[model samples]
Target: MSDQTGSAGVVLKYTVSPDDFTRAGEASSKVKNILKQMGISPDVIRKVSIAMYEGEINMVIHAHGGEITVTITPQEVLMELKDVGPGIEDVEKAMKAGYSTAPEQVRALGFGAGMGLPNMQGCTDEMKVETELGVGTTITMSVHMEDK
Candidate 1:
């Protein structure tokens, strides 16, 4: 497989729209395509794609809107999603499975089953979330190809 070598990494950025559930997965879809074009393995691509997609959906549902930046290198793929939403108050509780602040309408849409964060963790090599009350949240996720 021809993965990015040396300094030949690629960077991509996407803007997420608020309350736009229909377009929630668009950013992740683009990222997945780019990874494929770079010849990254399907497994790695899948992990990164799923994790980032979940993050994107969360941002749209919870945050007003956000920006997602993805960086690809020979060793790893990294994604950072930043949003200016009501920050997660209890990150520890939020990380737990079946924990979510999504409204009933969102639940009716078949989402907000509280698996977004859990799914993200399961799909990535490493994930970190930072937030402050009334400020915003920024999530950094990385998938290391070397681990394969």
Candidate 2:
């Protein structure tokens, strides 16, 4: 880990709206800009942005939107995404690279190629997904900073 700059960490929150395709990635983009302004490493920013954006898209397409909380510190960047939509029936299946539960409508939009979870797991240092069939889901992911 690198920086210990933020005393407790800088926290940012955002809301994802159902079917808000137009604004789906706004929060992630804003975070990327903020990271840049804070002089975060490019690799870290890229990983964080990719994970956050994928989560946002998943919420819009399957989970009927959700809320996202991100904490930035010198040591790492953490993001937690929560949704109240139908939870993943099979976490194992959903984690498959090409597996998608999106309906035809979502697929037709060219956004549901089943890569959200895979990509999220790929770029982050650690990731966790907690879900209930009809209750909701919460995904927590973190990307740790490293010494150059």
lDDT per model vs. reference? 0.88, 0.90
Cα lDDT tens digits for candidate 1, 76-138: 999899998999999998889999899999898778988999899999889999999899999
Candidate 1's displacement at residue 8, Å, is: 6.9
Cα deviation of 14, candidate 2, in Å = 0.6
lDDT, residue 145, candidate 1: 88
In model 1, the clashing pairs are none
Q: Count the backbone clashes (under 3 Å) in each candidate.
A: 0, 1
lDDT string for model 2 (28-73, tens) is 9988998999999999999999999999999998888999888887
Best by lDDT: 2
The collision pairs in model 2 are 3-74
Tell me each candidate's TM-score: 0.92, 0.93
